[model samples]
Target chain A: MKISCVTTFLMCGNFDNTLAHNLFYVNMETPTQFISRIISNDRISEGFFELSLSWDPRAPVPMPGQFMTVRVGSLAVPLLRRPFAFAGFDADSSSAAIIYQKRGAGTELLAAARPGDELDVIGPLGTPFVIDTDQSKHVIIAGGIGLGPMLFLSSALKSRNIPARFIFGCRNKSLVPDTKMFTDADPQICTDDGSAGFRGTVADYINTNVSLDNSTTIYACGPSPMLTSVNKIAQSSGARCQVSLEAVMACGVGACMGCAVPVVGGGYARVCKEGPVFDGGEVLWERM
Target chain B: MGANVDLSVRIGNGTLANPVGVASGTFGYGGEYEGLVDFSDIGAIYTKAVTLEPRGGNAPPRLVETPSGILNSIGLANVGVEKFISDKLPYLRTLPCAVVVNVAGASEDEYRRVVERLESGCLDSVDTNGSGIFGYEVNVSCPNVHHGGLAFGTDPAQVERLTSSLRELTKRPLIIKLTPNVTDIAVVAKAAEAGGADAVSLINTLVGMVIDVKTRKPVLGAKTGGLSGPAVRPVGVALTCKARRAVSIPIIGMGGISCADDALQYILAGASAVQIGTANFVNPKTAGLVSSGIREYCIGNGISSLKEICGVAVD
Candidate 1:
């Protein structure tokens, strides 16, 4: 399936141009703090959960690959906001879903949050995936909870009837999210322990089954090592790739300069502003 | 009932509308938080460090979280003073509140050049009165740099020389930002006072580092970074108290100031005004929150003015 250029513009509305402009420029979006109520916070897998938040209808629609910074505790114990990518959004319900892994104190607090609880969130922030109309295929590769942004991107592409594929990987079967949650595309699941689908890493699956062509555009979000490998593969194959990065962020806004990611050239880019999503070639993974 | 309480503060030659202003490097040029925070309610906006030339800053992983604090090695990433004057100052001049530019450099000459540029009216065409920079918060405490920053801040002789030199260059309120990394913060504060600094602000982030046990390497690209947040608040308060006793000049206190109570604590420790630093990152509206918190504290205590409460705790 493929979406027409006209249809894409119509779907994006007047904000299409502004959104497109923000992708290349840093600190374009004026981040607003929203008191979103938790519609649901359910544990989907061990040490991982999918949280749905009902936000203001007037708030800007979150784009794929963009993230939200969630304040974990009411007090100052966990003083920083944990950045989580948008896993999905239900426009009809005026809600967005974030899939997170319990990695530290912040995520542990986030896991304890109950339904109907209000959370201080700032987002729909960072750069989103830039889908080139010329690209014939959209390949989404995700590792573990990195599936958060990929899920949203896949859902958005499916709405446009854009041809896309999902390559999901996890350490084992238990770590994998329910396949039913991903209804848009039949995911090619890979597990390191061979407890699930294809044995070995997502890179192995991509190496064996996936062939990178000129028209192929790959979008990946995962561990740094996986992203580095993906970038290498895309560069060698002459295919374009965009990767969403993760870092410890203070203000999800551009002001903090807390989440700086090294650029391929010289200088650094803020993961919260310049990108959560950056061209794979543009990132300096070796430095990170 | 709390609305009538006075939050204004005297810092150098000007009066801050409130005692709550964000510290440098935390609030990026004041325009970044336009919609999120009410500028009118803020006493002042301290812009990110501006240098003589544009600095790209350090490598990746410029910041990390430790305990209740954050370690950052941004390396003073900023547009040169020229760009700030041409592009950023116009917007800053339009704001109703006071604008304080935090200036950093590798040498005294660079600092002088930046001060001269500001004083020459090159950046103040918008504000018929003068440049938008109401004051100069000379950042002598930045740990990320090699030659000038912490070096100037830690040594009394360098602090005296830098402060006295800049004092001759501009009449703008010179607030020498002091580093707590020094052996004795009071000595450095006294040096600034003797060198004719109008006021002093302490303490900048404490130099610290975090190591990744797995990689057996430093977490920050710079190997070490300055620590700021709630974890450093006690150290800030203690240094402010010590510096207050050492210098007669007005003191601006900052360090993990998260609430109004924290601001009040600084005032009582002899700070005429307080700069909200790391708190701004955790809560963008912290300055406003701290301002209101001060008001509420005053009303609750029947304190008519901040002057009455300032240094009340000191003997």
Candidate 2:
């Protein structure tokens, strides 16, 4: 379960010296079709569920911010795999977890899944967030189920002895994830109803309290609108920012070119390939 | 019963070691799925469509999932044939299986030019010991493009002219991929044969459109897209039967072939070989699975060769 950093960098060919660049270069090891066994599928809130699967130690460990395209059912009803970001992993137990809210037919089927069920998965696909070590302060932001990757990123950052603060924003107190889940960092929890922590949105909380400077690096994952606001704040304040994007993908690989997001420059970048994680400046927010 | 089944069969002048091959566009240049799939187990790899000039393809939302199927409006996005030859062909030449370049163009002359370049460089002289491409699969059935795709494929005259011209360009095997959008695929299949094509493959995606009720617009970037998957398998089988009765040449059957049973239906319908398309998107290892499954099926049925069952349903 211990991922050898030397082996990881060697496997990922283009490893530059900088920690941020090295994170981006983490080779998405050739994807394999793994028949993973579901260890637990627990409903945490009204609609959200935290599902964990026993992992094969041989399979490449998915880095924080990367995702897996999971097949919901044995039958081809949905036909396409639903992509989910890594929420957490227990190397000692050889299990990984994903947090999701029941939304469509795919998630509805996933909600019906129970422990001891076998699920087909292809991953650890897509790009991971680049953690800039030079930045003195790191801020992790999550919106709703976007907390999945943020929690995973928080743990990874902790392993590097880097300090990070978590800011979570949801609709109300009932929607917030268990505070015990984020024991490493005291989260600045915010709810729209003012029933839990801060009264405004996570962006509003950051705008009011957090100070962004050249030494600040912000990592955010959430709804597109929330990401747009955070991206704007990062750009205006001269702080480095990386955001994880979401899209409906047919093939998690680049062949289908289905999950494309327009970048700041001109052409489209495949979210399943070039990113699910991208620099705030690289993305064309309005175009998305 | 350990029956020694010969999955290998002849297509055009070339021979495939097995009947299962990955379809064009599904398998990208044979390099994308390298470590994920064992190339030695596959019969051939048909690369994504290559045109005379590089094409950017359609805008976002190029693909959407339907019930047991998928609609794609990729617009045949590919690196130009020149770049394909320079950048992709070298890696393809190293693969253990046969390689078939899927070529597309805006016009017949454009098709001829691409084939001429491929022949002079990649396909012309095959070192008996060295690895090289087996043939060319002419893609005239792409529904996403505006130019020579379905436009040239639907018309029998255009199919004949395009096929005949490309046939004259290279000694390598030429397989004309037919469009199901035509009124009668049999007529187009016969047209390809008349043009001296070595073989024909069908059915390309059926033209379909999905409307987003809330937005009141089509879901795909291209207003319409080609539909493929199990939904199109019956249509593909029926058309393959019709084309088999109409033409004497070999037929490559495709459309919604996800498992060995689906592939067996195509062989029984008259396909000498089968290609796995949209299923590749759903399962990257489908081709390998189908290959082993075919062998398992042949052994279970006590059939010694695939040719025994091919076209059995048609006769």
Interface Cα root-mean-square deviation for all models: 1.5, 1.6
Q: Per-residue lDDT of B57-155 in model 1, one digit per residue for the tens? A: 887678888898889998999988999988888888888778988989899999988988888855433232223667889999999989789988988
In candidate 1 chain B, where is summed lDDT lowest over 10 consecutive residues? B122-131
Flag clash pairs in model 2.
B229-B256
- Kindly provide the TM-score of model 1 when superposed on the true structure, using C-alpha atoms: 0.94
Residue B64 lDDT, candidate 1, scale 0-100 = 86
In candidate 2, stretches whose alpha carbon ends up further than 4 angstroms from where it belongs are A1-3, A6-25, A182-185, A193-195, B123-130
lDDT of 1 at A211: 92
Docking class of 2: medium
lDDT of 2 by residue, A1-288 (tens): 223562343333333366445454554457666899999888877688889998777776778888988888866678888899988877778888999999888999999999999998887788887777678999999998898999888877776667888999999988876645655556888998899999989999999999999899999999999999999999899999999999888778777767778887677888888899998999999977
